[model samples]
Target chain A: MKLYNYFRSSASYRVRIALALKGLDYDYLPVHLVKGEQSAAAYASVSTSHLVPTLLDGDAAISQSMAIIEYLDETHPQPALLPADALGRARVRAIAQDIACEIHPLNNLRVLRYLTHDLKLSEDDKNRWYRHWVESGLEAVERQLAAQPGRFCHGDAPTLADCCLVPQIFNAQRFDCRTSHVPNVMRVFEACMALDAFSQTQPSACPDAA
Target chain B: MKLYNYFRSSASYRVRIALALKGLDYDYLPVHLVKGEQSAAAYASVSTSHLVPTLLDGDAAISQSMAIIEYLDETHPQPALLPADALGRARVRAIAQDIACEIHPLNNLRVLRYLTHDLKLSEDDKNRWYRHWVESGLEAVERQLAAQPGRFCHGDAPTLADCCLVPQIFNAQRFDCRTSHVPNVMRVFEACMALDAFSQTQPSACPDAA
Candidate 1:
């Protein structure tokens, strides 16, 4: 398997964490997002959306980080990323989407670029936009976590929710988003960061990191 | 099952289509998003994120439309929303996330509100921002559909991908985004709209639709 991804992309970070948790081995093929490498024809052939974290398994190429993670879990089910029960799976998926859909998309690199270049926003305004989404989105995650308190996002074991939460928190801290409001979310982040699966596969530790 | 959802919300419409496809009945408890109902304390207690389309089944209150649809598929598997195999499921899910994560999140109500209200962009600028993401996002979907060339998103059957696609295209048309660029996507949209599940549960057909 070859994973084509950027080191700093939260979506890419998600797939990396999932791969590590499953104890899987794959070649890390970096597609640098900042350098416009993802838009090149060669990389575009692998990813339809030209987004980071396209997992290539033999002849098959899977895009979308959440789908890739679910594919990995389905193929390698020993340490399941989702719970065994249907309702449990729903709970975990909702938590994952809380970060993936609600937070990450608004603060995407392209969206930020549009804000500054197209809309003519200042640097301060751009960073403010970034922090606003991250701060509010994490608050919702905090509420969810408080409702269902656990060592991880779901249970004692780290599931898909943890895989998503850790990366978002990493990006949030990078932008200096207000983390003090989400104590439960921060607690889960601390627990997730303690694991080798998360710590070793983070952005700075990736092969392509500056 | 009781679904607390807004009529025109793309995410809510996805779950409605999924339920209709499965031939399952759900109580339509409308949470009007435009009226600030989603932000109210009563709605917030049911949905931690205060997002639309929270499905209440017995005691479990599942948030996130994708999660709700998957939960419904799991509990009642008459007409499965996902594919039978892992790779097939991955492909279907990737198509679904193509809209759910990439396109829909960028054009969300709150995001658009921030663009005009917070950033103070003109109405035309805000509308342009809406069209930009939708047009570009649909082009990516077109490329994926062209590669697959299914009667639906996956095969002859209407999978989770189609459930997402139809609502997105509906919104695209409402906003007058460019649909002519993606013939393949429009073709699938036409095919999906022919089905009762897609047509009957559409935004206009909903009880709360204005």
Candidate 2:
């Protein structure tokens, strides 16, 4: 398996954690997002969306972190990322999408660049933009977990939601986003970070870490 | 089952299509997005994100259209929203997330409102902001579908990918985003609309549609 990734990409970080948890080995192929390498024809051939964390398992090429991670779970079917039931899977996917679809998209590198260059928002304003979405998105996540959260986002064992949450908290701290307010998230994040799987795949520790 | 929906919400529309495909009966409780009903405490209880398309099934409340749809699929199990195989499921999920996570967030109501009211982008500029993301997102979606697209996004049956693609195309056309380019998408959109499921749930046909 060949994993096309960027060290700091929370999306790529997700796939890496899933791989580690499943104990599957894959060669890391970095595609730097900041340098416009993802837009090149060679990379575009593999990743149609020109995004990082494209996984190729022989002929099965996949993009979108949640999708890739879900695919990995489906194929491997050991140490399952999703719980056995429907409601459990929904809870996990909901938590994952709350970050992937809501928080991360608004503060993505491209969106921030647009805010600064095209919309003429200042750096401080851009940071505010980042913090605003993160705070709100995580607030919703906290509410969702308020009922079901245990040691992990769902129960004691880590599920797919935890895989996504760990990386997001990593990025949130990187941007100096408002973490002090989200204690539930902070607690769970620390728990996941304590795990060897998550800690080993931390952005700074990646082979292509800048 | 009860679905908190807005007549024209693209996200809600996706869930509605999935419900219809799964042949599950649901009470379509209209929550007016434009009227700020989603933000109301009643709706927000079920939807922490304060977004439309919250599915309340018995004790299980699900948010996020993709998550909700998958839950429905898991419970129903006959007309599976996902493809049968792992690689096939990955392709479908990648197609869905390419729209849900990547494109939809950038063009969502909050972002548009922020662009216009907060930063004071001109109406034309706001339209440009809407069109810019829509065009590029659809183009990327087109590329994702170019290789394996059949009668629907995956096969002859309408999988989860088609459920997502139809609503997005509907919104793109509503906003007058570029459409003459992606012939494959238009064909699939037409194919989906021919069914009672897609046709009946359309914005114009919905009860709250005004």
Candidate 3:
């Protein structure tokens, strides 16, 4: 198996943690998002969407972090990334999407560039734009953590939500979003970060780390 | 089962189509998103993240349209929303997330409101922002459809990918995006819409449709 990834990509970071957690071995192939490698012809063949973290398993290829991670979890049943029940899975996905769907999409590099260049917003305004969405999205997630958080984002063992949460928290911290307000997110993130899976997959440690 | 839905919510609409495809009988309880009813205390009880399309199955309340729809498919196994093989499932999920994770999040009502009220982007600029991202995202999706698409976004039948595609296409149209560049998306969307499940569950036909 090989993972087409880029350090600093929260999406790629997500699949890395899942691969590490599953105790699976795979080649880490870097595709730099900043260099426009993702949109180039080489990467497009590997990923039709031209996105990072496209996992190649034998003859099969997969993209999208959540889907790839879920693919790993489903294929490797033990050390499951999801809880045993349906509702539990729902809670996990809801929290993940609170960040993936609601937050990260707006703050990603492409959108930021669009704001700065196309919309003619300054850096200060762009960062402010980044922080506002992060703050609001995290607030909703923090409410969920306050209500249902355990050792990780869902229950005691690290689940699919943690795979998503750790990356978003990494991003939240990188953006300097106010984590002091969300103690539960901070706490769960600390727990997740303590794990070898999360620790080994940090952006700075990746082969593609800039 | 009961669904907390808003007529125009793409997320809610995704779940509605999934329920219909599964032949599942679900009571729809409209939560008016435009009216801020989604954030009201009563709706908050069922939704931890204060989002719409919270599926209440008996006593189990599930959030996240993808998760809820997946749960529905899991429990009712016939006419599966995902393919049987891991690779097949991954392809289905990536296609779904290409829209759900990357595109729709950026163009959702809340984000549009943020672009307008918070960023002070003129309505024209906001719509431009909407169309730009929507068109670019679908262009990538068109590349995806070229390789794996059949009668629907995946193989001949409507899968989870189609559920995501149809709503996103609806949203792009709502913004008056350039559909000529996304013929594959338009094709899949029209194919999905032709189905009774998709047609009946459409935003215009919903109980809360304006």
Candidate 4:
């Protein structure tokens, strides 16, 4: 298996954590987002959107970190990323999407670039935009996490929600977003980081880390 | 079952199509987004993020349109929203997320409001922002669709991809985004709209349609 990723990408970090949790080994291939390597012909062939963290398993190339994680869970089926029950699965997915869909999408490198370059916003304004979405989005996650009190995001086991949460928190801290209010979210982030699976696969641990 | 939805919300439309596809009856409780009704305390009690398309089934209140659709597919299970096979499911989900994550979130009302009010982009610039993301994202969707030429998004039958595609195209049309480049996506949109599930649940057909 081969994973095309960038060190700082939250979505790429997600797939890395899932891979580590499942104890699966893969070739770590970096697609540098900052250097515009993702748009180069080489990377674009693998990912239509020119995004990082496209996983190649034999003939199949899966884009979208959530989809790749789901594919991993289905094929491997151990240390399941999703819960067994239907509603449990929905809650976990909702939490994951809460981050993946709501928070991360708004603050991704491309969107941030658009804020500064295309929209011509000042650096301070750009940072303000980033912190606003990340802070508010995490507050929602904190509320949801409060509802389902657990060692991890859903249960004692780290599911997809935790995989997503850790990266977003990493991003939140990077942007200096205020997260002191969301204690439940911070607790889960801490718990997930204690495990080697999450810690060893984080941005700073990646081969491409600056 | 009860669905807290907004008439013109693409996410809400996705859930409405899923409910129609599954032939499940749901009470359509309108949450007027443009009017700022989604942020009201009453809606916030049901959804922390205050986003529309919150599905209330028994005691479970699921937010996020994709999660709600997946829940419906799981509990009901008659017309499966996801494909049976793992790879197929991944493909379907990737397609759905391509639109739900990439295109819609950036073009949603709140994001547009932020662009205009906070960033102070001109109205024309705001429309350009909307059209830019929608067109480019649809081009990516078109590439994925072209790779796997199905009558619908995945195969002959309507799956989660189609559920996401129709609503997104509806949004694109609303914003006057260019669709000529993506013939496959437009074809799929038309095919899905021909079905009652997509047609009847569209914004204009909704009881709360303005």
The best candidate in terms of TM-score: 1
Docking class of 2: high
What share of the reference contacts survives in each candidate? 0.80, 0.81, 0.77, 0.72
lDDT comparing candidate 4 with the true structure: 0.92
RMSD of 3: 1.2
lDDT of 2 by residue, B70-140 (tens): 98888898788898888889889999998899889888888888777767788888888788888888888
Q: What does candidate 3's lDDT look like per residue over A118-146, in tens digits? A: 99998888999899988888888888989
The reply for model 1, stretches above 4 Å from the true place, is none
Question: What lDDT is reached at residue A69 by model 2?
Answer: 91
For each candidate, what TM-score against the reference? Answer: 0.99, 0.97, 0.97, 0.98
Over 4 Å off, model 4: none
**Per-residue lDDT tens digits of candidate 4, residues B108-180?**
9998898889888899999988998999899989999998898999999999999999989988898899999
Lowest lDDT sum, 10 consecutive residues, model 4 chain A, at: A44-53
Residue A63 local lDDT, model 1: 93
lDDT of 1 by residue, A1-210 (tens): 999999999999999999999999999999989999999999988888888889999999999999999999999997999999999999999999999999999998999999999989999999999999999999999999999899999989999999999999999989988999999999999999999999999999999999
Give the range where candidate 4 chain B is weakest over 10 consecutive residues by summed lDDT: B44-53
Q: Per-residue error at B205 for model 4, in Å?
A: 0.4
Model 1: iRMSD? 0.6
